[model samples]
Target: MDTTTAPDRDDWITTPLTAALLRGALELERTGHGLLPHRLPARARAQCTDPQLAMVESQPSGVRLVFRTRATAVELDTLPTKRNYTGAPPRPDGVYELLVDGRPAGRGSVTGGNTLTIDMETWASDYRPGEPGTVRFDGLPGRAKTVEIWLPHNETTELVALRTDAPVEAVAERGRVWLHHGSSISHGSEAAGPTSIWPALAASLGGVGLVNLGLGGSALLDPFTARAMRDTPADLISVKIGINLVNLDLMRLRAFGPAVHGFLDTIRDGHPATPLLVVSPILCPIHEDTPGPGAPDLEALSTGRVRFVATGDPAERAAGKLTLGVIREELARIVRERAADDPHLHHLDGRELYGPADHERLPLPDNLHPDAATHRLIGERFATAVFGEGGAFAEGGTSSPSAD
Candidate 1:
């Protein structure tokens, strides 16, 4: 376990963290310490200086290292950027999940990494650099097997080193690629671990490879994001829209419709015939009818529990203000109109993934993101809805849904 710096352990084989062994990241940047995975490409990242986008895009939601190894012991050195709120309870260390031949093998966490302290009220942030830490997994079967280490979906990590008792090589790509884009819910906000994130879970169940671009508080239908999706190679694609737009109060209905059309058009430019599914936001009591900009409940924060509330007026809908309800209706219409000519285009009401009944059974702890259990529920439902028989991504299933 202490072998990260133990020079006497000459049997330890160090492997370079190369792109061949990595999956789900659009680009990997050379950092001062090591390699930092980026969900968005350098071009997309340069278009925005928003700190929130910068942070979430680098969180590596569905990023993982896949390799074929006969090693019984593995160690990875990492420098993780952990977040802390000024007035809220500290978050736990992010978990690194290991899978052996596509099954859960082990889980570990690194300690002593960089910290970013954010003031929720002022939206100001401070950073403190720290030393790198090591995560180790031992006692694995010595036989050859495919191994995957899923990075923390909520933390930005820099891969510093990889060492194992035996040499490791990259694994060949497998399964269909499913590229998805959405907000923090799809970003694994409150999920227990990276593998447990809804998209990851759904991909696993659907037997597909996942490339997640679910940036937190940053999925505002940006052109760069749509372009990124456009250029990325994938057999299947889905965009979970509405939540971030409504919560951010980024645009009115007039802008939202055209923006969505433009986003899809850019994607279609690159993948004109790819199966593209447009999904609306799930049921969110706060923003279902009420418009947003969503605000943090300062009162709840005082008790160390983070909560959110919609701040915009429902009456503003007359002014073309967007709400979850309005967004869903618009998304359905757009998909219906587009699908008439594009047989591969389809729409799925997100409520099918998490609806009012499901909400009653398992309310969102923060009035926003789903809890771990709900994430699983959403994932299972998504797998069936999008990848099951007659679903959009199903084999020989090209017919679009009539309504969302």
Candidate 2:
């Protein structure tokens, strides 16, 4: 076959082919085309040769895995700097398989190792509830032909698998930047599926990329996190604040206002002209406007004794502190005032992403994190809000849904 001549599309069906025959002749091409809308995988330059399953994972870390023929070249593009997918039940020690040339070539693991080796920590073995761990792939045979990467079974993750007949090579491409910071909802909690999380969903919908800086229980306007956001690169940005602040009773209104201002200031230091959107929390009754720092009632957990009646104390909210509604209004006001001087700044009500209508239809089981269906709703809203024609999105064009 001539290497330069394009194959006739109809010729694909001209010959009798078997499963093994197809796998042997195909080359899994790895061109980093980046993601599309609807939380689908990025478009491919060409159809992969020995293509296999395309999976998404949040275990160990948020990554897309592609297995292919002869592991000679590797290039991972579109790394999220802000918030990478993290597991709910932290993974302790496990073996991940790497298949090469249609066979198992090597393996990677998280067993005995430093806690902070891969810029993460290990908590428990059976999927630690919220502990971050690193997954490293080392030791490869020079002549290996195939690879299979394993993910933590206890936790949900995202991935894309591939198999090729040619040497694997990495393709480089500059992707659009999306900087996002939110509570556990944004961190992929209790979500139906890893790839269905709101952030991932929205990223796919907008056809842009992101740096997820979502912390499980740590979205309390932390200066460290703000500093981290300030230090990162972003073409477009958003901050989903309030739920964690209210739930944790981390700050009062006096502290909350200034903290929010400071957080935006920090981010603006680097993303001066980028389109900045500030998003507040969705509906959550317990911490809507109450002082919580609410911990699960041990009594409820121990003997299943007390019911939901004793879960949270709502009196603190009456004393005046940060509530999701309060935060939403403040965020809108602050951005408006700031927008007078910085037109690029934007504000989005969290409810607009998933509000009362959604609750009336699909109530969040925990009254906090949204499910996969909600993620889809929110992702569609985001896509239409910014990327749609005449929408606020800076990139103006027909939105392309990322459908792999």
Candidate 3:
């Protein structure tokens, strides 16, 4: 802790950070290098073996630095580790969205931090740690205002320090907190920017706070993740299921039903009456009828990109293999059964956000995740379906004891 809020212009005042400003992240650890934010709490993280979960959770997809300041100029030093798949296009610099007074103000980018490159062909990995970089912003309103710096949603960001011309203080938020969990699609897979991700966009449109647990390739309905959701304080909750299960072929229909029940039960243990929405998968033709064990299209990778393909046979569904269509039907049935005694439980067909018709116009570029425009479309649909007037989960809106 620095006692000096010494503000004289050129002297960069170091602002102290607290729990109030950091959103989405579960905990902040002060390391010798800087402050690292973890999406899953220590206990939860300790129970997971999959490295993919570890990566996406720490990426800080919906995390940002929020504070109130009158400084005309500000600088945030951070080290961002961008994920890269071998034989794929290199990702652009992580974007920093600077919002002032709840409005788009400016933007910044930090380059040269670190890269975690994976060779999907060989399942080998390489890590390169780079130097810390700074994202500087100037030309502010020069008046005390709430400012939010949304970090890169697709990269793991380690915040180094905050330097502002004036002292900074955390602002108390005023909105219902929405805790959301889903797969990579919800993790802003192909979204345009950090804030442009569907969840972030929906939160902005719905006038609510978002704690996105959209772990890419990691939303496996793990008990620990459910615990994370249970412990977190939230007024609204949603879990998008299906794609990850189909892609990983983690379990059969018999196991899927019980897992979903257990997931909801754990959350209800902490939040018995919070409005809970269970959403199924959107239209992914490859996985809709076919089972998976999704695999990367080697041909597409040779062209310097990553594309996914369903490898399992549709007929295999007869033997208890999971498919998007199968998961959707099961989720709806489970939600309906549970709602008999739990009036707060609700169900949503993910297709309602992006169905077959929408797929024709806005196709999933990689045949797995929606592209940028689709992200916007899905976000808009979710805002209307869940938060609009008379919507099921809308604040103070009508509550139905059945799936919609």
Candidate 4:
């Protein structure tokens, strides 16, 4: 484990956490105690009143603070909102990943902050406030280098202070910006750490900066979300659609097609020619053929393990209910049709990233989200499929592949 200690206050230099020093967040909100990073702008956030959307957008999956300093020791004070299920096992502390000059250097975790407790059976929640905690790292080389502190992907953190042994200056970012939006899976659920999330991992591998707008359980083709994506500047963009819609049973097939079209249309209004890829859902056995309104498996929950089961009937498909299979087919056709006029449009079958074979080796722990190993696999595959040679976002690459 990385070491944490209370260093001499007089020896430390404090820096203000400003927008320039941060990456992958669309907005920074001032709180009573500190600053909080948000993935959606104020306009979009005001359009939705859902608490789940509000919470996940503030999680900061790809948000990190970057600066150049010669400090051997660094400390950041943060107030994190940690979630807990009423009956489920306690979750591990959220990790703060430190990277020096773009290489992993150390990892640390804060001890105390705020807590959000949820009743799994009743779906009610309680919030308890706590004092801020410091995440400290020491024993550096003391040579001038770029430092990046990646915030925890699953926790909503308020940045209170940044203290270093030496003066720090903001470092300007380089490389292409890849903006991606998807469901909870893309939001980094079940991943071990912030940077370990598939999108962050893929961004590093692809040599691109990432702006992840993956709203957990809220990527249901919301107009506000599409508008947010439209306004955010990015060179490469992708939207992973399906799982959330299926699991929530939010819409029927009739609404699904037009919703996707409008979502893409909204994005194109701002980024008319940016390389955009549409990804279908990965191979999820439960929702592949069956429709869903997924429900928690009470039997597994009783055993201190959380699992999900699909509740929608396959017979509902006759009434135009959506399933993963139907979604994949519709997405492919839509991309193909749009690619004819919109040359920059492309599509990638999510199964190519996580198919049956991969699932057999590493099944989803909750029968919904991928495990850590699966996240790495998906990230590697995504980097190759979208950012590799002849891929959609590759330099000089033109024409969208219908399926890859």
Candidate 5:
């Protein structure tokens, strides 16, 4: 494998099984140039076995992998919890394209979402040691320039293993750095494919390295989280906030406005005038102008049998105080006004990432979060708006003036 490519562009490669290893680990730590588990599987008590990550090839240029997590806790929601926000649960599967030098190699899949518990020692599947396991991508292009790999969402994956038929060395190179954070949407909820997920796609399109802080259901404007952002190194940064805020009803308008400013302010504390874009929540019918701490209208969902509290509308927000749009508009105004003094700051509407037309074609199966198609759409838009030629992701003007 002629793997001499620029580092940030397309250097590191992972096996399709990388997603499987991340299935449900609690903490991931880097190990021997790869990553290792910090916490055992939640259901390890049953000796969960047959947990091998398998990859299969498909026709017309595509790849599929099945991550079999045999454990008592291996439910349909193994990858992601199904809620109104994450649309519907996808079958436990992965679809991908085998690319050589960014060209198609083949397609693959594992085909089922089964939850079973087996003896760890009894699980005797061959631990394949080559890039090509049972199915191989023959006829790889002779002039292949680079290889790229994508992973599935909901799986708590780590870079545990790497194997290539041809030997390649790990090389480091400098490229644009991207730091991003958001909700489960940013976690790749129901996207068509791993690489197609918005953040991954945008990174691929923008030719930037990524530091994905997109924790699932954890984008709350916690002071420490903001402080974390303030200290992290980044070339381009974007924060997609608001959805989780509304969903959780975490703060009232009085506290919300200042929190937003403080979050940005903390970031500015470090990178005085970095090209920072604050992305507001995209269009969501519920919680637009509503104060949350939502109560589920059990009568509305179940046919009188089951009852639970669900999300609320935007108007009910903070004593009818703040809507997401209100926050978005207010944020832009704040940034623009502040930009006079902090010229490196910027703002972007999340809708520009994915809006109505995107919904019509790829409606959220659950009316809250986006599906895989919408993920691609949003990734495309984000790339075009911020990092494309003259996009916001560009280094642009920095306050450092004399510093390179």
Candidate 6:
């Protein structure tokens, strides 16, 4: 039998977990139930009835709790909202990773959480609430050290309470905060783990603090999202555009241009000179030329595997519809024109991270998102291109094209 008791404040400092210490999550909502990590703020989430957005925002893909601690054993109470598939293989439990002083330490998972079951054809879902789960890690070095608890990238987490054998304090963040917004790929897609995701990996390699706003299937150029980014405190910012716009068929080229401009304009209103990088979509052959309202490959689905197929016709390009190729060109033009006036803005071709030849070497398993290996590849490539010597975001992030 295990005997554990909550320690007094003097024995363990209990700080109200706030957004300041969280990474990857965009916003934090303090519900009466707990602190819910949200990819979209209350204002943004309130405006949407889309099930996909709701699910994506709630899934704290790269979210984590970091602090300096002297405790050997630590515990956190969390309410995790897990998704349940109707006919697919039983989904695995969301994982929690513990790192001590920048080294891998231990891992755990919370059990008996709420589940949301969705029907593929109807695009409908039913939510069932369950009790919260407690995550515990022990057997660390008894001396003071930095401790990071990585939240599940695929689960919506409501932080309840934190307790440790000894005192814990927020770590003094060392580098600039890198605020990033992107699609499912940035939300971790099918990455092996939360911190192992590309953005997380890149942040680690680049020596930057991370605030990942990677909302899966929901990275459309929404004004609210741009406003959210504008309001957030960040030393550096990046927007990975195109994939969601292409896959959702949400906007044509005509609307996309203004929307991209508007999105950048909103961010600039608050951070006019902050280094902002605009990244176009990586190579996805299906959506390279074919336009989309992408559909699930029914043949693969029947075999308990998920795959995507572009449904829009290539001939629709004349109609101003969007494809990755069209998006890349427009993004380049937007950044070039804007950079003439806004010297702090820069653009990077996403293909530089994952291009055609690289695609041939490491193909996306689902025909959409990158596999675990590809995520690693993208992360390494991004770190080298944007964080290495003389890169776009290299020194202090003041490097942008000279204004015309």
Stronger candidate by TM-score (4 vs 5) = 4
lDDT of 6 by residue, 27-140 (tens): 778876789988778888888888898888888876788888768788888988888766666778888998887777888889987888886656778999999889888777
| Candidate 6, pairs of clashing residues | 24-212, 61-153
Candidate 2 has an lDDT of 0.51
lDDT of 4 by residue, 203-319 (tens): 999999999998899999999989999999899999999999999999999999999999999999999999999999988999998999998888888999989999999999989
How many clashes (backbone N, Cα, C below 3 Å) per candidate? 0, 44, 0, 0, 33, 2
lDDT of 2 by residue, 304-341 (tens): 32222113455655566666667777777777778777
lDDT of candidates 1 onward, in order: 0.93, 0.51, 0.88, 0.91, 0.52, 0.86
The lDDT ranking, best first, is: 1, 4, 3, 6, 5, 2
The C-alpha stretches of model 5 lying farther than 4 A from their native spots are 1-90, 94-99, 103-145, 293-310, 313-321, 357-361, 395-404
Per-residue accuracy of model 3 over 290-370 as CA lDDT, tens digit each: 999999999999999788999999899999999999999999999999999998888899999999999889988989999
Residue 355 lDDT (model 2) = 73
For model 5 the TM-score comes to 0.66
**Local lDDT at 33 for model 5:** 32
Best by lDDT: 1
Error of 4 at 180 (Å): 0.4
Q: Which ten residues in a row have the lowest lDDT in candidate 5?
A: 54-63
Any idea how many clashes model 4 has? Answer: 0
Candidate 3 segments whose C-alpha is farther than 4 A from its true place: 1-9
lDDT score at residue 269, model 4, on the 0-100 scale: 98
The segments of candidate 4 whose C-alpha lies over 4 angstroms from its true place after superposition are 1-8
> What tens-digit string does per-residue lDDT give for candidate 1 at 65-175?
999988888899999999999889999999999998899989999988999999999999999999999999877887889999999999999999999988899988877
Worst 10 residues of 2 by lDDT: 17-26
Q: Which sections of candidate 1 miss by over 4 Å?
A: 1-8
RMSD of 1: 2.4
